[model samples]
Target: MLRRLAAALLSVLLVVLAPVAAQAFVWARSSDALTLDPHVANEGPTVALIQNIYEGLTERDRAGRLGPLLAVSWRMLPEEPTVWEFKLRGGVTFQDGSRFSADDVVFSYRRAKQPNSGFSDYFASVVAIEKVDDLTVRIRTRGPNPAFVENTPAIFIMSKAWSERNGAAQIPDNATTDANFANAHANGTGAFVLVSRQPHVRTELRRNEAYWNRGHVALGIANLTYRPIPRASARVAELLSGAVDFLQDVPIQDLPRLRAQSGLTVTSGVENRTIFLGFDVASQAPRGTEAGGRNPFADLRVRRAMNIAIDRDQIQRVVMRGEALPSGIIIPPLVNGWTGELDTPPPFAPARARQLLAEAGYPEGFATTLYCPNDRYVYGEETCRALVLMLGRVGIRVKLVAQPQAEQSSALRRTPGPDLFLAGWGSPTYDSEQVFSSLYHSRDGQRGAYNATGYSDLQADEMIGKLSSEIDGGRRDALIARLWQKLRGDLIYLPLYHQMLSYAMKEAYDIPVDVSNMPKLKLVAAPTR
Candidate 1:
């Protein structure tokens, strides 16, 4: 009995003496990264996940402001107005311990401009990339690129040594099932190292002990687990059960209950993303539409009718749970060149919509399928269902074909793709040029990589190209305003609403919600232990 009591006393002492466990943050959301390859998919979830692993010459902070990452400084040469030079950071090493240099920057630029890369549009104005020295590179544009600095954050850099050794020089095409070493593995110079990745399920990352900027940023999260719980109910349950420490995409309907729940901290902000609808405007015979061998979306009146039919207020209330800001234009108010007049949504008038449809030679509107991702945007599927009901009221019959984001993205990229689809665009550059070039411009060369709607105008394309080269800020803004005014009349896209983002986490942790909706957890300070 004396020996047992002594043993119990020793165990208690040992427990009290042990140090606190390292902070392991578990972040859960509804969608997973599409690929491990940083340059393959220009998708939000994929980009956010890869950002923790890979980094660019520049990065956007939580407030959507441009800042340096791999590069120490950058400037435009006064003598050579077309050339912008960047000074690379020294002593920075990749996760594999390989040294980073100008060669890697040049190599990454070339790779990102590959035909299969979704980020090709970002380099459309680049005339050449020249490495000046071991730590400096010069980017020569077709002209004086006003938007070049803002666009740098989207161009993630990769290790030249790693890519060559692993034969990942080319980005894998998501449209096809093309797989490369980069598709499954990664070697980047970021604050975190990818430990394991299971597509559509879970991914794990650990903090980089030898991170170059560890002193500058917080390295609180030692171990990070990313869980992609597709179902909203399951995601909330995981957070409530203490299985996940952070939840990124909280369902709108559950916001009240989650806020009232004990031991939880919830913060919300307006997101930079704008959810909108697009159609195959250029297709003569679009797929999934019963337009009697003609494209109804090609008609201006039909497009306008469909646009005004969607009640933004109703959707904001029912589908978004009063959490969304109604928008009339595709670009959110956060983006440059956005004006109050352009953002004011059109009046909801089903009667006028029916009249426009009748004028377009469709008295009892045609049937079409609305393709939308079930797990992409906030209330993506539910919004499409509501759209179906709303359009039906205006005599348009819509069959909802909601699928996973991966399948939906693939379908949208196909030539002569779906007739009607729901899509969201976030301006990483915070400029109207990004929206015009990627969404409205014709799919020629590298300009319209994401222009699935097939909407094109030569004048608009010229203006978009000029926006990249225009040096004067006022002139650029004028050009953007002109484009918005023209595009609104063209009716290429039906603006829905700007998404509002909410992040939920345990009281111990504090993670800020980024306007871009891509949070960099490494910058988050350590939670109170």
Candidate 2:
């Protein structure tokens, strides 16, 4: 009887300790994804969310190293240097059970280059995509492209049959009020499958059982839920109340308090993004301006005055709370073309700025509105308010207009965007090409999707076009340096500081901060007990 009682007790204990087969992990951030269609927006939040449901030919590892995802191997042909061949992974199927093939890659490539697609800049050098076989696809470029591999990680693949059947062949325009099948539903080969999506409120997802990388990657969380809490205080309350297991965007002011709290872990790192100010350089007579008949921002003297008027060091210390690295260039140091000389900010001299404004025929300065996204970047509104005061020191009387990121993006992309706007950029390719092509290049069908500033230069455009195909490393660096020199002199943008990111989560889970500021939950490790 004693032995039977002991065995029963052991069985009960084992049953009680058995690990749960399914548990949903909840996480929160400040902003929601703008759209589910992967090709629609190249914005960080949108891309990060879609990456959970879709995949690319390549993907960065937890350590930010590029590796194979759907494609097993890839290389540029020896004889035909412009042609790149990618070998697709076999036996992999989409969430809907459709087999992935080279045809899908070709379709995705073509679809991504569509007029409505925001990722056209990455494929500007590609002449054609040809399927050599069921699993082999060759991309022919206009010239010998060297950074093609680095660019593929952002070019996510889509199912050819599924897109066609669902009428998602054309990438939905995120800037407009339009709807499509892909806007709400997703059929991807990624580790997560979209269960339901309620924009700006909540998005729920479950692990993909048919995931090809299931055994290869740690899909610890059975289900994942994401909530976009724009308010910082509300986000912290959710985390402290145990309603949220993880928080992606930890407010800088709350970091010290949260770090001192128990049952929580806070991790931080520098993000590969730069926040800056832009002007409507192409507009002849921009809106919300006090200038008469002529665009004040079009004057080089006026742009230079605005650039040097603001003190970057003061902003980094006070506004950013020392969570940023003051940068002179747009691209972060992690990118290939960054140099110490290029990263040095101009001297902070309000007197000189005033003189320049006076020389530009604005002795009394002018009044214009500065549009900023409230919840997009860290302390975005605060930074813009600081700028309002800083520019006020000079003769420029400024008005601030702050709104959500969605509306801000729409305002910038529309015809004759804001007179002056605050924007941040993340170099997904970790190369200078990504920055120059998308931000500085002239507005066109293939490039300049993100050039909302309307700044256009034909000489810069030619150099940017050549940078895509230049094979020699030395020559490429020279070309990049020359372009940066011209742009720096032009002062098209007022260089701010590189952003830093921090994440707060329960101690039971460990998620590293990616340089791109997009954490991949699939690589997260959760405690069993």
Candidate 3:
């Protein structure tokens, strides 16, 4: 017994005397870092770093449960579903050493709702934000949104004083004539600080030593660098030889090689993204339009023919090598807003497409250009090439225009010009309304922003409007189903497949891992070697 006691004491002493590992780490993503500003940074290429440098009021965990970040506790008003009162945790401090308060929350949210900002979801249900006290805040919404409370705190908070000081008087939109404060420097209470940025090149983040979270893994000094390499070969070579520690879009062809490497582990899951195809129904097709221009696609027979011609099974097996599945809806099943039932097949039947095209007045198959991004989605270019080959067999000539990530985002911004393009959408808030309203809402469609294809359905728009104002559970779900069924039948957007995020890591580079998409490397809880 005495010997055992002595060993225990020695072990304790050893732990106390041992030097702790430096609380620093670097996390990598596939694309070049565009911007560190979470508000202005909308693309997946930029979100990975955004997670590291900012803290929302709350964050999601591995189980996708909402937990505390800035606010410790909150309660709903008994009188209405739209009103919520929150009590902020008092001890939190910003990276600049200022104490967190209700005032910061108010400033961040107001900026989110500003005109033309891409991040209006932060105000999707929010109507009024009131600062009741230093530690108290109240949020009034347009209606009782079930996901309101869950999404509210996670909308990366910005500092009120800092915004005015930096002349970022508005919320960030990539369209702003000048960069917002968030674009230049981060003022959030997160674990990292934005040190420097060069668009489509590299962005660096340094660990925040004065982080508000203590006694946690989030307290660590760290450096993170991101670079966008569009070529699959380059990204794979970097990962295989360890020139880069990790890459996000691990190519399906190279997964085997990554797996065989002894020093790294490949990580992946069905990411919250769905890939889809769209048609522009609101405009006339040009006379020289590819695929026989607008008239062919406008005809119901032509649209159905194109749908019938797709061979999703072949793409899944050959292109993705069983890594992804064909989809029918915009939302992935992992998300709650997903549509559960649909029937679609693959190994595309050009013969069938020909018959439909003939019936729709195109007895001779036509040709067109497919606008797609080389680096946006995983293997986006390769997938386009495969589709081009498949469609070519059916008498449809497809020209491919593949550009880098920046030009791709620029094209998406144009909305209607691209004939048919491959695009992906993931609801950051994880809701159907977030998907439907952003893409299908007429208000947005009128501006030709989210509704790139100009898809318009009055009934579908009404359902979303009703859903927005609905405070009751049963009625809202029915409205959601109505919208789901409508979109499912109209078939304007042809969902290609959902995505799974892939991560590669060295086993020893451990941090508190979760799927909430919020990243913090804290020195306080850095693991001991």
Candidate 4:
């Protein structure tokens, strides 16, 4: 009955008013927000919005390499990126008028070290943080964590006094619990400021007139409001009706309608984000009576079967509506040190999937709950539904369990979850190691805000460690490909697709989104008139 309803709904949603070339536009959220703090935000939707409110130490450039953000200039004192000194850009200040300095940098680092902040691992290798002066800081790491520069993506500098005074130095398990002013607030030099948040309804933010880096190459975005519309249909309707300017995660089935509409345009390509499935290897064996506590995913054959069962092309065409590209590994082609050939996502074949399952002794299939968020990415839930349907074709009985973003994230973090789930990864840091190690490294894969899969390979971990410390670009690239192949052989994860971010907009307004895909209110290039 439900399948019939879904098929019918999909049949009618081909209409969209997206422009061929997009400009400054409205964006809709399919889920509620988790946290506004830059350090603790885990979900993509949370990032899509909060990224505008904070400035990090490093960011992805148009070419997707680690470029300085707060750090004006940096030099490696050691062969590895382990020991480096960064020269901060002078004349910078926080939103509170406190001058940005080495003190603020140290304070921010300490705050990130707290368990609640969820960003400490990005800096876990830092042996010391030495304040050089008002505009410089020297960072030293004991061991080479190769992805340090890239991991700096989430290292947003904060005012020491403002945070301590506002009681946001520590983040609670939930933002609403033990409420602090910073939970619903921000004090950054970024372009946006929070106006209000209504949980499931919407979050409004306006441009910061005093944004430190106002109008460099950024489009002139000033005022922005984002509404969390749970229903993809509702988002599209609002977009088509002129109630919204931009809506991402457009249901692929609705592309026809959006294309037919005259007032809008759609811009899409292979985004650097990847959606994948993860296994919880926290336990030595899978935890369930079905296999008597045997972790089937421990076997590479089972993992490959899951991969084979996936019809990525079909999903790309029918489910994604041609808005995405199939992917195999964690890093996309856009990032630095990306090799042209390695870990190619294999094509889907149900017969091969069944054969592998039969070899793994699960010919009849197994039942497990697939955790998914109802409103995170576009058609995120539907994508999971489609996966469940596809897996069923190969004899796997996957019961879909979808929830709100906050609840779903909390559950994944709190427990191994109901066996498996669907999630996303976008490398704002633009580092392949950061994307892979942060989620797959055993030492750090405890769901400490990043490793949702809870799957770890000791070899993969060691390779990541090696790559982290390797200083040469060519050597680093070689090590990365080897590790990627190892990950694919182990089938630690089943990657689905690389996203192509599309924004539908009215012809008059404009927003600039290229390789550095962070949506910035300050960058909304508006109509000249």
Question: What TM-score number comes out for model 2?
Answer: 0.97
The TM-score that candidate 4 achieves is: 0.87
Worst 10 residues of 2 by lDDT: 15-24
Cα lDDT for residue 333, model 2?
Answer: 87
How many clashes does the backbone of model 2 have?
0
Q: List the residue pairs that clash in candidate 1.
A: none
lDDT of 3 by residue, 1-529 (tens): 9999999999999998764544334444446645555566456656656766777777766546678878888777888768888888888877777778899888877776664555664466577999999998998987776567656544777777876788776754454345655665777777777778776667777777676665465453456666666677877777666666546667888787777878777766666777777756556873335654454556676666676676777777888887777877888775665655742433355687889888877788787767787777777787788878876776767788887766666555554636677788876667777777777765451222466666777778778767766777777777777788777777777778876556665544543333433334442244455
Worst lDDT window (10 residues) for model 3?
511-520
Query: Model 2 residue 64 lDDT?
Result: 67
Per-candidate TM-score against the hidden true structure: 0.96, 0.97, 0.88, 0.87
Off by over 4 Å in 2: 1-22, 173-175
Q: Across residues 1-529, which tens digit of lDDT does each residue of candidate 1 receive?
A: 9999999999988777654334668999989888888887889998999999999999999999898999999999999989999999999999999999999999999999886788888888998999999999999999999678888898889999899899888776653487888887889999889898888878989999999999998778888899999999999999999999999989988999989999999999999999999998888877788878888999999999988898999999888988999998988878998899999999998999999999989998999999999888889999999999999999899999989888877776666667899999999999888888888888876888888888878999898989889999888888888989999889888999999999999887778789999999887766653
Worst 10 residues of 1 by lDDT: 15-24
Better of 1 and 3 by lDDT: 1
C-alpha RMSD of each candidate structure in angstroms: 3.6, 1.7, 3.9, 10.4
- Of the two candidates 1 and 3, the one with more favorable TM-score, higher being better, is 1
